[model samples]
Target: MSEWRIYQGVGKPHDGIDRLPAPPPWRDFGNGEGEMTPFDRDMPAQGRHRLPHAAAYQADESTVEAVNTALYLRRPLLVTGDPGVGKSTLADAVASELKLGAVLRWPVNSKTTLRDGLYRYDSLGRLEEAGVAQRGARQDEQPTPASLGRYISLGPLGTSLAPFALPRVLLIDEIDKSDIDLPNDLLDVFEEGGFEIPELARAADVSEPVMIRPADGGEEVTVRRGMVRCHAFPFVVLTSNGEREFPPAFLRRCVRLQLPAVSEDEMRLRAIVRAHLPGADEQAEEIIELFMQRAATGELATDQLLNAVYLMSRTVKEGAPGLDGVARLVLQHLNVTAPAE
Candidate 1:
């Protein structure tokens, strides 16, 4: 029933996520917890969000259902929406509300690769260190497992896979901008819930766990036997701008979500304004009307109204020049230029 939803999307931090039921058997992996680092305590929860604490992300019932479904199934959420439509904020909202650690963001680009998201090996650096050690005398002194592991740094995707006490929130932003092959490349990792580090696997000492740094900038995590497995599948959120179509095989593994434009909901828009400025209800209403009117036929985003309400309204109320000009300039369509009358 609806009571089983793990993420309520209420903008209030709670531990309800801890009560999530077992993941599907097919998605299960090793149950070992990630080695905790001293910095783990310092990891920022939802309070560090750019959105105001009042409501970092205003989630309607539909959004709540999509997110909760993703959480329950232990599947990656593939969210598609217009730019600035709060696609990325969904990750932060879930993390903040469920007391998940800071959102791990992997912003993809055309040049991004699967390895770029998983981990980066400093092969050149390792080779350089080996040369230095050989020349300095010490029997060629091949770098120890500890030293070699230090050369490998886990990216956001890699960090999210580490077996941890709780599920980490990963936001793979704008995945549609990635290279065509990137989506297909992710299929294996999603199915396996882990990846292998060949460098460590083939090393002289393959028995010991190697410690590597996580993309979150926390202390190194131990990858036992060159494998990074998850105790709990991370809450992975992959965002898209509807720019490209993904392969069918890749799409089949994800929970898809279509985000409505912010202007479509007047109450949500007002909540966003009031979250930033507690007493801006009147300003919010006025700007909301104007924003919706232009947004009806244009590509104005929600933040434009936030800007107009916070800046233009604040200025006008303080006895400055009227904000008509300011609002006009701030709320312009994304793809057009206004006439300079």
Candidate 2:
């Protein structure tokens, strides 16, 4: 069980500046094909988690190329656009394309700390040990990595840096929600390819820790000091809603990609639908188009269109009404409460 602690302190004023990593002299080997070598074969699969393939929805050829660049380069892809413009989906799509595990999401917020993004040490277990020792109960504990591992579970940010051939996808969602320092803080890990866990590092010198993994139906991945080395530098994707400006130093480390709104011709929307629902009929496409147009006018959420299509299809399969029913189903899926009649 995880417990969250809220820390209170006098808030400091924003200086609007922080130290950032110097850009590595990256050589543009952008060959005509831009093919990248696969991750090392011998690398362990500790932090390399894969995502569900069907969820990946690529907008076009350019989008695929952009994602490939970020993945091969192992650099942060800064995706900016209006809300619901699939900024976050880019990471998911990449993970799915590569068959990497579920996208590790770090939803940024004003109060989110660097430690929160990295890893947190569990103090409860430590306190329990202190209590046991205070009563003068002498006990010999096994040096299993599992016993020393609970304090060192990596957060999404730290997990992204795990050393493995198959890299994980990390979506830093809505980074604009954070203060200016967040991006700068992230630069080090992005460049260095990993972060150090002080707790695990300290314990590692004592004994070779064991990693406790789920027993197929197990619930947790309990890891010891040397049991896992997450060498897989994550294909990091950071998204913004364009709420705030970023310093140049932070931007230099990442490749910036801007996604425009869905076109009126409905090219991207149609493509997304086809990718998501290959066998969807004409009625489903029409309903999805309607939802997409409606969404385009307001807070255009692409996921809502997907939801609408699924709901409409289910309704039709159950032998419900036609276009009107489909529209109603789309609206219902979007949770757009019926307007005052």
Candidate 3:
């Protein structure tokens, strides 16, 4: 197994690096007589869509420094880079390294909204459930208190802000793909460290601490008075493909870092390749050079290189020289220049 370096705070405040005190644990907050369960902290080493490259992914010093700065300052890291440059994978790497549990990923599309990322209340579902209970009950019996807990669940962002022993890792993937107003809407929640669920708030007066499930489908957590606040701010990673520009205010609140484009650096390429394709060190140089050459001509992603290498490796092991043609198909450049209109 490869040894991973966890991000410790910087020694002094320099180049936007500010030292910060350790975040307080959830236990520090007072817990009244109620069932208080922490967010699921037990994340398996592998899962569907989880990055297998997390353990061995190698980041440059500057990227590492920026991540540490974000951690210490309790600010979101806005990572801008081309697709497949490992923007989304950064969240996985950090979570795996810091033992921060499963990453809460909110994949943004044009239809995604602030409410979609926070929480969703199924009012209709609750009403139907209530009606069923009332019909089955005796004339004197009362229906359940809406059973809002069953209908209301926190989304990825909401779950991240839930008071946890340690901060959770949140990946707001491809913010550039979201609607224009989405970025601005996120500013308030990011600064406030929480949001209010109106449905839960209205019922707060009548109910005990409501137990709600998060989007991860993990253990239930108790939300007091329908407001979800972070005892420790989540380690947020917002990725962009440089498709759209963000407002000044949103950019100011985030710590921005742009990953390097294509590079011929042998060590960097080897580290990345070795993570996905172990024991391919002998073929790293040849494949990495070919990848760089292709990337120079068009918009080629790093994953394309990995795919090509994996196919080539299989062919070599099986002594199938004829399979070289099939391997070339995988290495084709994804982007072609548009013709003049």
The C-alpha lDDT values of all candidates are 0.80, 0.57, 0.74
**Clash-forming residue pairs, model 1:** 34-163, 163-231
* lDDT: the better of candidates 1 and 2: 1
Best by lDDT: 1
Q: State candidate 1's TM-score.
A: 0.91
TM-score versus the correct structure, for each prediction = 0.91, 0.67, 0.84
**Clash number for each model:** 2, 17, 0
Write the residue-wise lDDT of candidate 2 on 1-341 in tens digits.
Answer: 11110101111111111121222345222222212223322111233433222354555545555664555555778998876677876665554434455667888999887878776667788668656766666555533344556544667775654443355667888999997688788776665554566656555756544442221111233334443334445668889988899988888878888887653437667766776677676746677567755654445466666666776666655566666665555443322452421
Candidate 1: 10-residue stretch with minimal lDDT: 38-47
List all candidate RMSDs to the true structure. 2.6, 12.5, 5.6
Show the colliding residue pairs in model 3. Answer: none
Candidate 3 regions with alpha-carbon error over 4 angstroms: 1-20, 23-37, 46-50, 133-146, 317-327, 338-341
lDDT of 3 by residue, 94-189 (tens): 777666778999999999999999998888886776677678884464433236777888999999987775678999999999999999999989
